[model samples]
Target: MSKANKESLSVGTKIEYRKDFKDIYLPKTMPVIIDVPKMKYVMISGEGDPNGEEFARVSEALFSLSYAVKMSYKSNEVPAGYYEYTVFPLEGIWDLVDKSKPATDKSNLKYTIMIRQPDFLTDELFDRFVKRTKKKKQNPYLEKLTFGEIAEGLCCQIMHVGSFDDEPESFARMEAFCEEEGYVRSDYTHREIYLSDPRKTEVTKLNTVLRFAVRRFR
Candidate 1:
């Protein structure tokens, strides 16, 4: 089982392959954790299904938008220091997008939308994200763009069950499982490729893929 798949089931959850995201820049592929300021998006955050409309909007942005993405090596954080977003061999990132309102109270109000780093964004990329947000006028935030280095190597990951609120318990279990198997965390940041939008999904059915970069200790 792959790191992501194995982790998903260990916590009693199911994860399906969305698709194979690839690019022509194969060997030069860079992973980045970004600091995207609260910016607006075309699809508004709602309840019951984040993947409902907002995802379509973003899908259009990443795969449909004519703009290119940015790439870098390190967390978007200032000074770039964190132990949670460094999972490699899978391209981990600490994405920070500032949303008008957080999906949950625990989310960083000033910073929202955390995803993988070293994106393939070009100059007009963020401009497009903003354009999408302009579709809604109720509340506004920016998607600030910052870059981080792309850590490399093999990784083990899992898709978590339940709400973002339930991450702690799953994390604990996953940690123990990895450790028992003789795998050690690289102190890389804990990362989640959020599939279900917290705003639009039920707390019980949320989908978050958690991944940690593991390497054999020398």
Candidate 2:
């Protein structure tokens, strides 16, 4: 191939989460223990059912900001460390506001939804992206957006296929795996990474990464 062809290929290549972070993003259906590293994200917090309008708005805001950073090179002044990368999938740290409610009760759910930013995204760059996104888009949830690092540390994760409502079956399997492996869940909250777009994919074809922090039995 010519040098120009090579350059085109390099620029076209995107860093895919499944290919680059297989242990974290692409796991087998069976639960496994892994140490998650700290990573940066553009995040927004909200409550109530994820199917509701608020959740949609929060997700939209996060993606808008993430894409702004990913496509910054198109702008006149690119970020110093900017590089080509695919926008990371949307992830959520989920919990319930009312402990008495079962996980099936979506109304009590509270969550922080986020999209992972590329390593080149700094706090300063994040602020600039947010500002640029706000000007380009009119999402009210933009004000709720924040940029930070999250380290999941030791955790158990599994790939879940099927409907989001069917996740408890996978979580149950994860709990059983942890019990057999001498580890226990460390918190009530759990994380979900959406690999397939729910709006576009069928319920039975959805792919999600289900994970929760864990530690060796005391």
Candidate 3:
């Protein structure tokens, strides 16, 4: 979209992914197949239990840089193709260090936490924002952040509403769906898009989008 067109658009227009791509974001309770196109994100990698302090610190660092970039555009120094938009929610791609192990053993999980960026953001722009954010405060994890595009291709996804510990119920349904549809779950671990803030939302009310990469069997 042109700058003039973006400017004239409503405040809601900034986040094209949220509005334009509901299949990937707002999936239904029943499993549905969708293709996730390539999209850019600011991501950081880490290991340990998700309920630990390290996970919290990693999340903080990502949000810090994301907010810095947003404020930069909103303030005096806006990057080219900058437009007003809502910040995307937190997302994670999780995997077990030992592929043989089940997901129930989460203590040794490896994860990449990320927040999506607008398509207009460039590598140079991302680096500048990183430096700008670092100068403001000292965060060792800042150096671990990487910006890149991920194309998850075809996936089966559903909206899971409940506590994190209760996700097994949803996973069971997804596994059954895969079996019924003749699709094999890929090695790629499940990806989660957090739609609710755990800090504020009740456990039973938590909203999470669960997705798994899959391939069809002949």
Please write out the lDDT profile of model 3 over residues 1-218, one tens digit for every residue. 45755454435445655687788888988988788999999999988799898888788888998888776654455677667767788999988898787877878699999999877789998998889888986788888899999999988899999998888798889878988998878856889999999989999999999999989985
Task: Kindly indicate the candidate among 1 and 3 with the higher TM-score.
Answer: 3
Residue 197 Cα positional deviation in candidate 1, in Å, after optimal superposition: 1.7
How close is every model to the real structure, measured as TM-score? 0.42, 0.93, 0.89
Candidate 1 error regions (>4 Å)? 1-17, 21-143, 147-149
What tens digits encode model 1's per-residue C-alpha lDDT throughout 95-202?
Answer: 224445443443332212333322333334445544554463222223323323244355555567686667667667666766776667775455556566556898
Candidate 2: tens digits of C-alpha lDDT, residues 139-207: 999988999999999999999999999999999999999999999999979999999988899999999
Evaluated at residue 54, the lDDT of candidate 2 is: 82
Candidate 2 accuracy as TM-score: 0.93
Once superposed on the true structure, which residue ranges of model 3 sit more than 4 Å away at CA?
Answer: 1-12, 100-102
